[model samples]
Target: MSTSRHPLRGDVLGEQPEAMAAFWRLYGLLWSHGTVDQSIKEIARLRNARTTDCAYCRNVRFAGARDDGLTEDRVALIEDGYETSTLTEREKAVIRYVDTFLHDPAGLTDTQRAELLEHFTPGQLVELTAGVALFLGFSKIAVALGPPPGMPTLVVPTPDWAPGEAQP
Candidate 1:
């Protein structure tokens, strides 16, 4: 079967089907089952997408997030100067978390950690951290492997995959 514009699958699946399957399984789980709200997670994910400049990542939106009220207008603030944007405090915290998580996890300060904990349980924090880690790692690989053809921003069902399949 054709890869359906999923570059990560084309490059990584042949040699690492089990691992890729496991990763996508986790992706599905992150979307399907989590303590944190899907909308919040989407905010963080979008922030990562922009910071990484992964065009494919930037163009895809999660259905769960959208259904939970993540509007395109809100998504636009995932860029620089979001701190000054009219985003809610909760949304701002999510962006901060992603920026720190992506750029310098070790530099995470006491205040930042406290702010995140204010809006998240420790378990939620774990989930958010894992999600961003997956996002950053997978998005980079997808971009580096040669991106799929470009498309306008599209809403996709949250990703899931069988052991040997391409992604959405």
Candidate 2:
């Protein structure tokens, strides 16, 4: 289903009306906290989209990442694992946290917390957690609504697959 053809009538704001307004107000405050760089924020979002396999987010964030000077190669790397790449230490830390939080919310160890503490201040940690959690929810909604036509698919190819088997 195309995102433009989503059953919802308006933006998240228009769709949920009062609830989204409250969310936007809260998000505005969180955005002001500046816990993570905007680039990191987008990267975290892309991570969430990838984790959720949300086509809408993958396409939107891919374009946004490129516009922000993230090369296609780097964005592609984010899918397999951002921490394994040449991103800065801090960027890798954030990606690690995002991965852990998404895949193991119930199993976040004290060691992981310490890793986060090493890279982020208390306020920044709060903001990072909030941002990651927010994107988790957003990606769910985007996938449920289905991405717009032409949005890229997040599926990776299996070794046995041939060309054209994986959707773009």
Candidate 3:
């Protein structure tokens, strides 16, 4: 892992601090009151990372997904659809919605909205949407910074192997 933080700290802090702070404040609100499932939150983050192609977020969320009890096969299935697998129907619905939200949020249909409503309260939906948007912003920041000079880029595991293990 690299010790270097964001390369464009000045821009991120000076030009974007207020916006970022708003996101953090929203996060605090969600944490304080939201009833969103932790697993659903992790799945949303993982999908967001995959959509953004952000290595940092992907790596971080891969570990988090595992910690949340998503098996290797289940995590792999998320890239496609995990509904046919062992995930609960609610979990499947959340992952499906996250995929659609990240890929085509502007095109979200009534059906998608209904699916979310079925599984989450209005406050939880707001919190989930806010979280997805926040991660999207963070991923852009990470990619723009371009890792660090001379640091080896870390690769996120692709779910066939245990995280942190060398594939044989």
- Single out the weakest 10-residue window by summed lDDT for candidate 1: 5-14
For model 1, the stretches where C-alpha displacement exceeds 4 angstroms are 1-15, 160-168
lDDT per model, in order? 0.81, 0.67, 0.65
| Tens digits of per-residue lDDT for model 1, 1-168 | 466554344465457766766777788778777777888888888888888888888899999899988899888877887899988888898888888888888998999888988888898888989999988998897677766776589998866545555654
Q: Which residue pairs come into collision in candidate 2?
A: 3-147, 3-148
Q: Clashes in model 3: which pairs? A: none
lDDT of 2 by residue, 59-100 (tens): 664333345566656667676755567887777777878888
Best by lDDT: 1
lDDT of 3 at 31: 38
Per-residue alpha-carbon lDDT of candidate 3 for residues 28-120, written as tens digits (9 for 90 to 100): 445334577556776777777788887766665434345557655665666764667777777777777777777776887888779778888
Model 2 worst lDDT run, 10 consecutive residues: 155-164
Choose the strongest candidate by TM-score: 1
User: In model 3, how large is the Cα lDDT of residue 125?
Assistant: 84
All candidates in order of TM-score, best leading: 1, 2, 3
In model 3, which range of ten residues has the least summed lDDT?
159-168
RMSD to truth, every model: 5.0, 11.3, 9.5
